[model samples]
Target: MEAALSRLEARVLVYVMEHVPAAVGGRAVEIALDPDGPPAVFASAPLAPSPGAAVVFTLGRSGRRVVATLTDADPVIVGALLARVERAAPAGDPVRILPLAEPALVDAGRAGVALLPPSAGRWFPDLPDAIRFDAALVQVSMAVFLSPQELADAQAHGPAALLGAFGRGERDLIRFGARPR
Candidate 1:
């Protein structure tokens, strides 16, 4: 696979590995950076087992980038990380680092995001509410790249749902694989 991650990206990956479970895969980490006020947004994809494969989604001020990593043949560790990744993402709209792994179906047409099964649905749901929920708390394995808007979004979602959606997105990416540019 190609090496697209920077030093910061790699650090974030390591953090996730250390904290999250192995089953989780396709982890996405989003960060928001703002000079004043709360962050704009923070989000991540779901996590799933990739065994030797891992897809990292990095969000920055400019836009979004993705890096794919293939670890040594160790499915168990991969699975563990995947789980932890799911637990670590943030939710709601706030200035913070939101790690989203699995990406529900992205409707370019509509600014909507949702969490669906592996390949059950075509369109995923958008962020439902803008309130942070305690029950929706998830752990943040690590963070590499972030932007202002992303941080604000995290504050909005809180933490619980952020992690959950991240885990789901990670799994979906692994299953669907990356698309050609």
Candidate 2:
């Protein structure tokens, strides 16, 4: 679909590309997420590509976990992203890369494992279940996270109408790395 990489996330993806093996290919850098924005450097080589369509990388739980996913794109990117993610991640923080052929099977509230085919997007073990969205909304929510009121308005207005509201809110949180106080 559209270019989903933020400025900081794109920098991390580029770092992963630089360190990953040639076999990983250019597509190995899909979507990258970091709660703290771009880091000074990324550490790691590369890993095997995923077997799904698109791939996702999310940083959450106060940077305690890094979640990566493969869906609707080159599997190589997923592998490469995971490798760099693990290296760059802090000690004890979990990193998972799952393969999702359909991006519709992911559940709310899980950690340390990547979901595969039929799963929609990656999972951040630290996030609450109340925030998770279904397949359709997950895609949109990635770009933004909706407020409770906004979500209710969308729900009442139409099912698909507010689909992107939650995603937008989510994106804001991920991009900025936390909720405003």
Q: Report the Cα lDDT for residue 101, model 1.
A: 38
Model 1 over residues 10-38: C-alpha lDDT tens digits? 55445434433334434433322335532
Among all windows of ten consecutive residues in candidate 2, which has the lowest summed lDDT? 135-144
Error of 1 at 57 (Å): 4.7
Each candidate's TM vs. the true structure? 0.25, 0.24
Total residue pair clashes for candidate 1 = 80
- What is the TM-score of candidate 1? 0.25
Regions of model 2 farther than 4 Å from truth: 28-181
Model 2: per-residue lDDT, tens digit, 102-125?
Answer: 221122111122222111223322
Give the CA lDDT, 0 to 100, for residue 181 in model 1: 55
The local distance difference test score of each candidate is 0.31, 0.31
What shift in Å separates residue 9 of candidate 2 from its native position after superposition? 0.6
